[model samples]
Target: MIKVVSKIMINSSAKQVWNVISEIQRDPYFWKGMSRVRTTSKNGNALTRQVTLANSEKCLQKVILFPIEGIHIRWTRGMITGTKDIMITQIGTQTLLEVEMNYELHGIAQVRSRSISEELRDEAELAVHLVKEEIEKTQAFPTESRKQWADMIHE
Candidate 1:
């Protein structure tokens, strides 16, 4: 099995970070190469989804949500057989987001594992970078409490 791990530290609370990423349906937005995603079925915290990649290859995945902790995704069908685990941790005032992908390439992909590893790593990094940007961007604007506090201090 080929494994890839990517991590990013976001300047936001773990709750804020989880609020953005916990929505698994938004994968196509953060995951650049993913063309589309649709949940096929839901059983409480576990759901099945049909994901289509930019290359038009489709895969069936089972995703399990773990609230503010992390996510577990297993690709059940397609040329790739794998499981991706996303872990969230808080250190100081920042949130540490980590993605661990363990997958095996079938058919012709086995021979190209070396190159595929780099590609997966790149994708994973970009995805977390985008999420960090999103969370930071939102935090850039002051909320009601901050704004009110600033106004009172000025007054």
Candidate 2:
């Protein structure tokens, strides 16, 4: 088994960040290599989306959503691909996003000289970077009234 973890700090609130990540079905452009994303099931945050890569390669992925925390997804085009866990936490006034992925290579080594573990780590890092960039581009949420009110001190 191989494990890859990446983290990024974004100048945004956790709720604001969650809004973008939670809308996986609505925004296909946020994905790195995906050209198109079709939702198989969309019942709130938990969804099944079919992603088509630029090279026309397609894969079905299971997307699970978490409040202001993060999103989790699993995909397997072939062999034992892996699952990605994206966790979001509030650090000071910014949001910290962390991603972790685990995968295992299958079949014989002679046939496939390339290391799937290394590839998985690189891909996971790239994916997290893309997600951070996408979240940074969002200007939708400026501030939440709930958060603002909670931050105030009554005299």
Candidate 3:
């Protein structure tokens, strides 16, 4: 399996970062090359979405969210079969966001594994950067977001 990791430090609380990342619906905005995300199903904390890549290829992804800690999105179909994890770490008032994507290429993609791996790395970096920008741009911590995390933590 090829692993691509990206990390970033944002000037915000982990809860603030968690709110933006855990929304799931806003994924395409942060995940570069991803054209769209359509929720297909939801069961408990796990959500299944149809993801459309920039190349117009479609894939199914199962997203499992873990409160303020992390989110695990596993590509269940198409040319990718792997998991992408988004982890949040709290450091004082700053939040450290890290994303790791582990996947094995299939068919023709396996032949171009090196290039695809490089693209994944770049995508991961951009994902975190966009997330950082979104949270920092708003600055204000939405009470609904805070309460949402609070409710999940208590559950």
Candidate 4:
């Protein structure tokens, strides 16, 4: 098992951040590597979505959303099983977001390969960092996004 954790401070309210994070399928602009995310089911806090990556790879991700707390998502690709957790907390005028991912490499080849865990951890960390940067760009520019996020939370 490989673990990677990343945290970022966003100049936004926790409610605003939570709203954006909860609605995983609606905003492709905030996610850098995802080309598209379409919801297949919406059963309360649990949602199943088909996500297409930048490399045109498509996968199904099972996401469990927690309003104002965090989201947990898991998916399997080939021999790699990935689990990602994203959390947001209010800190006065800003929001603190943390993303953690755990990956497990299966199969005999992975067991024989050295540094597989490190490689996976590095990839997960980089992915979370890129997402944090993408999300912060919205805060920096406040455009229509701030209002949209605020509306979602209040409603």
lDDT for position 24 in model 3? 83
**Which candidate number would show the highest TM-score if scored against the true structure?**
1
C-alpha lDDT values of all predictions: 0.90, 0.72, 0.90, 0.71
lDDT of 4 at 123: 54
Superposition error at 39 for model 2 (Å): 0.9
**Residues 71-149 of candidate 3: C-alpha lDDT, one tens digit per residue:** 9989999888899999999999898999988998787789988999999898888889999999999996556524577
Error of 3 at 89 (Å): 1.0
Candidate 2, residues 5-111, lDDT tens digits: the string is 88888888899888877767644455455678888887876888788765476777888888998888887653445687889999988998888876554555224
TM-score of each: 0.87, 0.68, 0.86, 0.64
Q: Worst ten-residue run, lDDT, model 1?
A: 140-149
When summed lDDT is taken over every stretch of 10 residues in candidate 2, the lowest stretch is: 104-113
| Candidate 1 Cα RMSD after full superposition onto the native fold (Å) | 4.3
Is 2 or 4 the stronger prediction by TM-score?
2
lDDT of 4 by residue, 29-107 (tens): 6555567988888898897888886657676788898888988988755354688888888899988888787867566
Lowest summed-lDDT stretch of 10 residues in model 3?
140-149
Q: Candidate 3: deviation at residue 69, Å?
A: 0.8
Ranking by lDDT: 1, 3, 2, 4
